[model samples]
Target: MATAPTPVRHRPTITRTAGDVGAVYQFACPCGATGEEQAARRMALVDLNEHVLSLPKVPAAQQCRTPRTHGNQLWEPCGLCADQTSLFDLEVS
Candidate 1:
């Protein structure tokens, strides 16, 4: 008797939004600083102008909430967000 082949499952893809890309910034420690200093020395993941320019074309997978604030704009809180409040039990002003 011949057995039927199983079907493959497809995963849904996430879409990135302009707000998501601008939410948080990433940084690298040059002096290998730890603790509070590390956070202070963090750099922007993407340039201000560049980030704004690419916002419209961002991918879905890269979309998410961030603590970064631009002018009067506000973003949702998430683990990766720059805002301390969004970072688990960390407090924010």
Candidate 2:
């Protein structure tokens, strides 16, 4: 039986300052298909927070990827949505 590969362990870059800190994380999820035709999708970006980053602990049935950017070192969520969670949880996870 075929199985999905394990999540990649990334050594994130950490920066600290009087104001706040942030890190950049990058990963790729492969498309489910056969042969060379199957392409690998990718995600990457920088998430900033005063604390740390984390994500919920769940077994990934399929690979996932995300990318982010920080226009200002100040570091804040792109938008405010009730459903959206903080990057702090995402970075640690």
Candidate 3:
């Protein structure tokens, strides 16, 4: 008998939180991953982007395609959905 493969969790979104004046900035992912505190906002953003890029890529076909709403308007083909499609296409070609 073969063991079943573990289900892959959707990539956790990472966000950067602003710190008090003179305090260092920090970035954290919902998956419990975190970055070292940095004195610059740019550094914090870089850390967050790096974490997102490091996660395993989900196939475009398997990614969520749900419509997203911004303000009062509904965005057909969510930005994330578009990005995943483009990214996957790049990897395949």
The candidate maximizing lDDT is 3
Q: Indicate whether candidate 1 or candidate 3 has the larger TM-score.
A: 3
lDDT of 3 by residue, 1-93 (tens): 122245333233334455665767777765677787888777877887787677655444444566433211121223455556668565552
Q: How would the candidate models be sorted by TM-score, starting from the highest?
A: 3, 2, 1
lDDT for each candidate structure: 0.28, 0.27, 0.55
The lowest-lDDT stretch of 10 consecutive residues in candidate 1 is 33-42
Best candidate per TM-score, number? 3
Model 1 per-residue lDDT tens digits across residues 1-93: 122233121111222223433533333222231121111112332333233343243222222344144222221112233334334545444
TM-score of candidate 3 versus the correct structure, residues matched by position = 0.50
Off-target runs (Cα >4 Å) in candidate 1 are 1-51, 54-56, 69-93
Candidate 2 lowest-lDDT run of ten:
33-42
| Candidate 2 per-residue C-alpha lDDT over 20-92 given as tens digits, one digit per residue, 9 for 90 to 100 | 2333233322322111111112123223111124432322222122223322111122232212443334554
State, as a TM-score between 0 and 1, how close model 2 is to the true structure.
0.17
Considering lDDT, which of the candidate structures 1 and 3 is the better prediction for this target?
A: 3
Error of 3 at 58 (Å): 0.7
